[model samples]
Target: MRLATIHADEGTQAVGVDLSQDEPRFVRLRDEDLGSRPSMIDILSEPDGLHRAESAFNAGRAAGDFVEGRLAAPVPLPGKVLCIGLNYRDHAVETGAEIPSEPVCFVKFSSCVIGPGDPIVLPRVSSKVDFEAELVVVIGKRGKHISKESAFEHVAGYTIGHDVSARDWQKGRPGGQWTLGKNPDSFAPLGPYLVTPDEVGDPHALDVTLSLNGQTMQSGSTKEFIFGIDELIAHVSQLITLEPGDVIFTGTPPGVGDARTPPVYLQGGDHVEISIDDLGTLSNPVVAEPD
Candidate 1:
């Protein structure tokens, strides 16, 4: 079952999505058990959250209609937003960076997150903002020192992620301010829905692509990943504890704007759309930060 967080009269509520019919239907998960105005994290953190959500979704009560501008990030305030860089062999080749034996990880704070239909504000300080399409893994269960063999046990599902970057701050600064370059407001656009693992078979076999305006800029497969999901989980858990709602952006493929001959950076009035095989498309418009 697919899940999402949406704005309602009661406030932000977690919802289960039904796509069986011609038009998609949404049912609010009876999360009264979770407390007032529970977020997606609160629901998924419960031991039988998904099961309860599934039961509620199948109850066939009045289905709620999606309100315009009501969809929010599935895990709006994730405790941690971990990102992997250069985990794709093709991506590394395009950037002319060496393939590392260990996973290259980074963090994007919650302040950077936004949902579908949101505008990606192009910061005035940076002139080389770029886009990356990535497949995000959402953790369902908490675990420390999770093994590669047991990694799937911790997975809740998957979602599409857009890792927006400001190349000038990311690499041109005094010492390369990765966090500053990456953590700008609305830099991480995630959601549409958080699809269950059962619905997204073999995450590593999916096709990922990103388009700017109407042209495809990046296209590649997870099959080119140098460090797969299981390995990434096992590698990171050895140090940091994995909690429910924590997400890992599994890196982007080649064809990044920075690698193009006359690098194509984002400008005002551009639309960015990212799509994965089973996961849905995450689209956002770009606007210049007001003076």
Candidate 2:
């Protein structure tokens, strides 16, 4: 099943795919009528909530109302967003860093999130902005100290994500923490759609690619991940409680602009498009922050 959130009259409306036709059509989920799942977060937390909502949605004849161009981040206000760094072998190699035995985690503040087609603000404060395309894992249930064996059970689905970074702020800071480099508003552009685990099949084998200004820059697969999904989930869950709507950006592959000989960076009016197998392409235009 594919799910999405779209801007609507009252606010954002939760939507799901209706597979009854030749092409899957998106239908709105009337939360008021359904009486339980009010938001995407609520639906994700409940067991069998998707099934119940699907049945109710189909019976009400409310399918096919979705406007693909007006999508919001699938989980607009997720409780938190955990990001992994250097989790890919080639990515680690390009950065000239030793591969870590455990996942090197970071946080991309929720404020940085924007939806597909949204503009990624190129802050005037930093001139070295770079892009990293990654696969995001959206959590479905609450768990603490989750075992690696059962980690996949806690995943709601998958989505495409961009880890926009400011290299100067990230590496040149006094303390050298990445938070400042990664926390700019609209830095994390997610969605196009959130696809169900069943539809995505094996997360480990998808083709992940990213392009800037009509040129392919990063092209790789999840098969090169140094720390697999299960291990990363279990490792993070041990430190903090995983709740519904919590997103984790698994990591990005090689070909980051920072590693380029001339070090290319995002400028105003640049276009970035990222895609994963099954998960739709997420495209965003870059704009310089207003003076």
Query: Which numbered prediction scores highest in lDDT against the true structure?
Result: 1
Candidate 1, residue 213: CA error in Å?
0.6
lDDT assessment of candidate 2 = 0.87
TM-score of each: 0.96, 0.94
Q: Give the TM-score of candidate 2.
A: 0.94
RMSD of each: 1.6, 2.1
Error of 1 at 79 (Å): 0.5
Instruction: Locate the minimum summed-lDDT window of 10 residues in model 2.
Output: 60-69
Across residues 1-291, which tens digit of lDDT does each residue of candidate 1 receive?
898888777677887777876966667665454556567897789998888777766663354434322678889888999999998899999899999989999999989999998999999999999999999999999999999999999999999999999999999999999999999999999988999999997999999999999899999999999998999999999999999999999999999999999999999999999999888889999999999
Across 42-99, the per-residue lDDT of candidate 2 in tens digits comes to 7887688677666756754454444343788989888999999998898999989999
Error of model 2, residue 30, in angstroms:
2.6
Model 2 error, position 207 (Å): 0.5
